[model samples]
Each structure stands twice: as C-alpha cells, then as structure tokens.
Target: MTQIPDVAVHHETVVPQAQQDITDGGPDMVQFVDGEGTRLERTPANTPYADIVEALTPEDGRSMYRDLVLVRRLDAEGHALQRQGELGLWPSLLGQEAAQVGAGRAMRSQDFAFPGYREHGVAWCRGIEPEQLLALFRGVDNGGWSPSELNYHLYTIVIGNQMLHATGYAMGMQRDGVVGTGDEERDAAVMAFTGDGGTAQGDFNESLVFAGVANAPLVIFVQNNQWAISEPNYKQFRVPPYQRAQGFGFPGIRVDGNDVLAVYAVTKAALDNARSGQGPTLIEAFTYRLGAHTTSDDPTKYRSAAEVDIWREKDPIKRMRGFLSQKGYADDAFYASVDREADELAVRVRTACQNMPEPSQERMFDEIYVDPHPVVEREKAQFLEYQAGFETEGAR
Candidate 1:
C-alpha cells in the first residue's frame, strides 16, 4: 500500500480569450485521491491535472507494474550483494522506480540521458547492461560504457555535477543544429536527473540558467524523493520543487512521481516540447525515498516507523498493480512470470560481479594521454621500475 496526499482542488476561469490559447497553454497541476487511497474526480479549470485511472492504457498499466517490480527486485538484490561484501555500496531505488522508468521511456533512442548515481532504473531502461553498472559499485571500473554508445552519459557520483554536463551537451546539440526542424531522429534532447538534495547545489541552478538562456533542448527531471540524507522536503522548499523553474523562464510541472502514467505523460510532453524548439522544461517528480539513502545509512535513526509506514501505503508498484488488476491487463500468472524473470536477472548480476577482472596497472597510464607527453612517459617508466623492485615481494 502507498500513501496518497490530501490535495485541494481550486477552480478558476480565464476571462481573456487570447490567454486561453492551448498551444502555449500551461500544465494542469493535478491532485486527485488522498494518501489513504480515497479517490477524487474533479478537475479545476485551466489546470492540467488528470486522474491516474483515466490516463493509462491497459498495456501501459501492465508495463508500469512490471517496471516497478523488476526494478525493485534489482535494487533489493543489489543491496543484498552489498551486505554480502560483493559490492562496496549500493544505492537502493526501492521507492522511485515509477519516476525513473516513466521518464526514461519518454526518451528517444537518439536523446541523451545524464543520471545521478542512484538512477539504476534509468540505466536499465536505456538498455545499459546490468554488469556495466555493477562494475562501478564493485570498484572494478569508474564507468564501463561510452556516452555515445548508449546516448547516456556516465553516472555522476558528485552531487549535481551532471547538470552542467547535460546543459553543455544540449548547447552543443543546439549549435550543431541537431534540434528542431521536425526531424525526430535528428532533433534530439537531453534529460538530466538529480534529486531533492541536489537542488540545493549551485551546479544544478547554474545548469538551469545556462539551459534557459541558450534555449537548450533539455529537460531537468528532478526526483524529489523528500529526503536528502535525512533532511525533509519542507526544509528545502516552502512550495513544490517545480515552482523554482519559473524563475528560469520555462514551464515547470509537478507530477505524481509514483503514478507512472503521469510521469510518462509529463515527461513525453516536455521532451517533445524541447525537440520542437520550445526550449527547456523542468519536471519535479513528487515521490518518496522508501529506503535508506545508501546501504550505509540507517533510516531508523532519523525517520520514524510511522513515516515509513505511511509511505509504504503509496508504493508505486502497488498502485500500478492495482491499476493493472482493475483493468484486467495482468493476472497472477503474469506477475509470477515477471518475478521469475527478475530472479534470473539477479543471478546474472551475481555471476557478472564474480567474474569482473581487475584492471591492469599499465592500462591506467595508457589512456591518460592521447599524444606523447614526456613527463607522463617519465612517470610511467618510474612507476613500472618501482613496481619491478617489489616483484619478488608479491607486488604486481
């Protein structure tokens, strides 16, 4: 069960006919249903909010359920591996699968993705190999994939660093004339994902400034999971996170992060707008972090069991399951099949982790310089000689 929030609906009329233009119309901030699973069916005028039940197709509903289940299982298995000392640390995406998968699915194959460290679900959605991600946690590699290979940049561990990278890439795309002109394949966009805590960093804000001024085809998808290592959402913003984007002169939307339909719809619209030369959009996926910040942090120390219990009711997986079951798109057998697939994936991840080999010392110095550098050459020679001195002492 997942808890729903109590939101009030206010209606207003736009008297000016000119202002009612739908082309440049604003988003509908929708809040229906309470945290307790009670439903509300009213839509305020001029607001873009839609009911979750009405927004999804049967297939889409089933897909969301499967996405949540598979991602959560992967996260859980990764955490278990960390505890077993197979991984140095793992960031659990236990509660945020809907936000990642929904937004990720909105991207085109040519569009690029910039992810923070915890966006394993986004990587998964982008067809990144699970072993490639595990290699990072296992300390066998910094990042194993090339950005051009998958249209996804390497995961940024430093808080808020990837925002600048995304903004810069979007600017390059704009300069290369890779955006607009109605060619969806050539007209591409970039998505930068960060968290609630990252919003406080200067890099995040600077990226927005750059993207807005350049009219870069980029979407800043902020996953507001309500905690930045024990700091609650209220401590960071008086209003919603999306409201901050208005200062940058672009449309900003706050959607139900747990509602996969809402995330997909909102992100798809945002990316389409960007690709069409409409500039940037900021989307705040309002969700919760149902697990520890990482394997090392204990939520029990800072958050109450009551709080956890409340969020548990609003589990994204459960909501999608409910929708799928109600729509007759999925049955017990379907869920069982998904579970079996996830189990197989877990075994694959484990096997991959066990087989990862240590990088050679010579390879580290090889890629450090493209052209010949005398200083680096001297250092490499000295390093090898120093190691050679200890060869008999079991140093390699």
Candidate 2:
C-alpha cells in the first residue's frame, strides 16, 4: 500500500540536501572553498581532492574569480534584457556558473566541447563573444562563431543530443589515434555539457553506452542543478544521479558544483585521464538553479522563496570573491576594474543585439547542399514570387 504524504510533508521530501554539507563543508562534496568563502585545509584528513588546488598560484586564483564575476554579471544583464523584450526568451544559467566555467577551463585547445543551450559561461571560457551568445535569442539564425575554429560546437536546443554528437566525435578521435599519445599537445579529448533534465533523455543514455563500449576519450559533464524545471531530482531518479554512471562501465564522481576551484581541478584530472585512454567518466556537479526554469516559467508556482534564499548564500561568484579577498590575491581596485569591464561588455552586447541584421529569407535554401538542388530551388523561387505579391516588406 502507498502511504501518500500531505502537501507540507511532500514539499520537505523533495527539497535537496544542500544544508547537510554545512558541518564539514567538503564531506559528501568535493570542495576547495566553503559556502562562507573560507578556504578549507588541503590535507588527506579533509578533502582528498585537495591536491588539485594545492598548486594553484595566486594569479591563477585571481583570474578564476574575475571570470566568475564577469559571467555572473553577464547572466544578470541578459535576464534584464529578456524582461525588457530584447530577446525572445532566456534559459537562465544563474547558479551554474562554476560548473560550466570549471569544466570549460579544463579543456585544452585541441579538445572539443559540446554545449547545451544554457552554457553561456562555457562559451565565455572558450573565448566566444558575449554578443554571439545572445544572437540565438535575438532572432538571429546564427550565433556568429565558427565551431571548428573555436573548438566549441553550437549550442543544442534539443536536450541530450549534444552528448550523442560528442560521443561520436570522441570515437572519431580514438580512430584518428589522437588519444593515449605520449605527446601532450597532440592527444585529444571530448567534453559534453548537459543538465540534470537532459540525463533522462534516451540520447544521453545511448551516448554513455557508446562511450563505454568504445573506451572513447570523453568526459560527460552533467550539471545536476537539483531540478529539471519544477520537477526536482527526487521525482526524476530514485537514487543519487551520479551513481548511474558506474552502471554504464565508467567511474562517476560527484563534485561541489558551486565551488569553482574544486570543479576546475576535478574536470582537468578527468580530461587528462580520458586522454590517457581511460574510459569515459561522468562528473555530476551538485548545484541548484536559483532562477526560474526559463523566461516563460514562474518558479513561484512550485518552489519556496526560502529554498532560493539558502542557495543565494552559496553563490559561486560571491564564494570565489570572498576567497580571493581573504587571501589578498585581489583588492578593491581589481574588483572595480572587473566591474567596469563587465559594464562595457554589457553595453557592447546590447548594442550588437539591437543592430543584428535580420537574416535573408533565401538563407533557408542556401545551406541545404553545397551543390544546387533543383526541387529546393524551384520551391524557393515559388515562395519568393508569392512573397512579392504581398505589398509589404515585412511579409517578404
């Protein structure tokens, strides 16, 4: 018999276990920095993952913090732009900055990255222009960056599809003899970004199966932000989500997704392991989504304002900033400069988005094939003639 809980009990049941990490900050989580921005002791007695951050120079620390601030400011500004009607819709990456940044920074130039739609931070780490990140939402057909040139593929709006693409790419890398080479610069790896929601799709499961069977040099980076929109992880999986990776013949590690330092260390190690011919690994970044599911969602309908308040204390940007300040790695001047630069970036993005030219109507037919296609050309001509009959340019 099923014992159904009342509404109050049901809400408590689904709430995530974020607070449990408060006592010994890194237990059950791989963290270099705690929620209060204090750097925990790096010893085997504490977090075994401490070796990754142990050698980071002060300069490296400062740059990581700077990037965190810039990404957060960009995300906030994008949300405001959406509310002001500058974009069609936005899938906010509000609380997942650390997860994306750490994974992206770990990649070498020779490696390839496949991104989900909400990977603005990853795109930034890959040197993608801020305006390019907005184009897809700004009614522009293209995001203005070449995938092959940047080694960062186009964002996949279709959930879990990029993982499949990444698995195939990793297989190709293996066939090309790019993995397990002693030469560091010549070896290759593939990184795929997906969300907790994306893991449920069959494409993701299939990708893991292919990766495991082939022993491909791939890292499956899953940002498990606790909720797939309003449906929490409890509703989606019966056990811890990261554990599923072991079932597919790979090692899965859970990390403190809000801790940028931890994420960088873990991702880099995983990528190196893959390049060394180790099988695929799944990194489940344990984090939360602080904003609505999207511009179209109203989280208030299903979530408590209190839950959001708790996650705010663990904001990635704030945690990294505090750590840098305490260590004297960054001062007020450095922070002020970052703020000014972020403002300049926001202005540039807004201006570019406003000025993006509408794509030509014939562009739809232009990329169908390298060679001419008679059927498409005929249809295109007929469509243009029909448009000419309508007197307005907007109709065309």
Candidate 3:
C-alpha cells in the first residue's frame, strides 16, 4: 500500500510579514469599514468601491438591509427548528451575511447563480421565498423553486459540483452568442458560490481550468470563512484563497467578506468583466464563521470561544446597522419595521413547514426519466406495492 503523508506528524509554522506594509496594503481588500467599524476612503486599488456604493439608491440600500436581516433571522429559525427535531439538518450562515447579500445584489436579473447549500441570502435576493428554503430542511422536497424561474440553481449539497454547472452554463451562454456584445444590460454571466472547504475539492480546480481555457463568463465567489468543518484555513493552503486564482490565469481579489460595500463593489466589477468577455475572476471573501459547520456538529469541541468573540465584534449586520445610523439612512422606525418583517417571515416559515404535505409515492417515480424505462417502472411499482402491503398490515 502506498503511504499518505501524515500532516499531524509534521510541525507547522506561521510566516511573519512586516507590520507596516501588511497594514497599509491598499484598503485591506477594498474594505469600507474595518473590523472595529472604522470607515476608510477608497484608494487607487479600491477605486471602484466608490462607484458601486454610488450606484445604490436609498431604495436599493433598504432592500439590501432587508435581505441581510431576514436571511439571518430565517437561518436562526432554521437552526432552532433543527434542534427541535423539525428539520433534518441545517447549515447556519451566521457571520457571512454581507458576503452573500452583496454579491447576490450585484447580480443582474438574467445572470444565473450556482450556489452551495449555505446560500440562503443569495436565494432571498433572487426572489426565493423563505418558506421554500425550509422545505429542503423539513424533508418535504429536494428543492422548492425551478432554477429557470429565478436563474438561481438548486442548492448543491455535493461541494464544488455547482462550480462545473456554472462553468457549463457560462459556456452555453458564450455559444448562444451572449458574451461580449458590449451590452451590459442584456448580457448574461454566472456567479458560482462555494465555501473554503469546497476549494480543496478536485472539481473546483478542474472547473477553474476549464473556465480559464474557455474564457467563460463566470465569477467564482469563494467565501473563505476560516474553518472548514473542524480544520482551519491554514491547513488548506500555503497562500490565501484569492492568490490561487493567479495560477488559474485570472485576476484574483481578496475582499473583506463581512463588509457588504466591498463585496458588492468587487463582485459587480467581476460580473461586468465577464459580460465584457474578460473571462473568469476569482474572489475570495475573507470572513469568519461564528457558528458550527451544521446543526449536527459541536464546534465548541474544536474551536475556542475567544475566537468566536473576536468575530462577533466584526458582525456584518452590526457594522451595516452602524453605517445606516451614522449616515442617517435609517432611523429607529426603520429598525422596528425590519424587526416586524422578520417576525412575520418567521411565522410564515413555521406555518409552511407545519403544513407541507408529503409527496405521493407515485410522484416520486414520475420525474426520474423523460422516456419510459420499464425496469425503473417495475421497481417503482414493486416499492409502492411493498408500502401498500405495510399499510394494509396496519404498520404506521
């Protein structure tokens, strides 16, 4: 048997950089605010930041704010439901709201989104109802909405699978003559959302290779939230995630994932580049996950509370709310209204989950094949017969 190198058997060390250069490295990945909630002006590297923020009207700001709040609330509710045994499993997007909402908002109506399972915020921005998200968790359906309807693909549970799908979709868009007509309004692009963990998968690397070769109109948004299950980010790569893009023949950007403004600006620029036939861009949103990997995992066993506390200070919602208040964009009434909306949404989600009807056994076999397959038909019939026999025997 060939022996695999044991990482645990080797000692690891951190590379130290000079503080001044590292500190002044041009806007800390285009951040509008630091982790301490300090606002900074745009530098030459972050020049597009101002334009993207300027593009947002008061209405757009309100919509983004609403998305951030409602999505988080919905996520929290889902976590609770999972703990209560109403949901089979739940993945909390706890500290990564800004990354999802900003990039999601940057997408055009016609642009498609291929998302990992934690993209509830993206789904919300794409017009998916909160109730529909719960269906996946409640064992009611695989997915609730048609991907064609919203241009948002179904949540892909197999990590990095959606990267290939997004790349293929972008290739199709290119073949359909949708790339580089210089019409930003009508041109289509693709945004593939994946996590830090997914970046290690072979499919992700292959997708980037194919995307680079084809010059596909796709934006690979990687949310590097520090921890992939129990493993730390340091274990995944020697350099940062964004730096990997250079090897893939695309411009790579690192962004403060907790900063909504930065995420919006960078993603918008990437999308614009794709629409203009500039090929793929990789954006690594540097953020932290303040929750467990899923409802089933106990993060406490692997991580320290001190690390969580540090990230909580950099909470995206809090930072955004601070900005809103300071800019006089939102008042106490606005906060109250948002809270009420969240409450209403929670009620609706709970009701939907409680009332969702089980799909008929016959319907399960309906969409398996486009053309008739006798073997599958026979098996489905036999399974239904078995189920019917159990019911006839009074087996609940």
Measured against the true structure, the TM-scores of the candidates, in listed sequence, are 0.86, 0.90, 0.91
Kindly report which residue pairs in candidate 2 clash with one another: none
What is the Cα-based TM-score of model 2?
Answer: 0.90
Model 1: worst 10 consecutive residues (lDDT sum): 1-10
> Which segments of candidate 3 are over 4 A away from where they belong?
1-28
**Cα RMSD to native, each candidate?**
7.8, 6.7, 6.8
CA displacement after TM-score superposition, residue 303 of candidate 3 (Å)? 0.6
Question: TM-score winner among the candidates?
Answer: 3
Q: Give the TM-score of candidate 3.
A: 0.91
For model 3, how does the per-residue alpha-carbon lDDT over 205-282 read when each residue is reduced to its tens digit?
Answer: 999999999999999999988888997766676666676777878877878889888888888888888987889888
lDDT of 1: 0.79
Comparing 1 and 2 on TM-score, the stronger one: 2
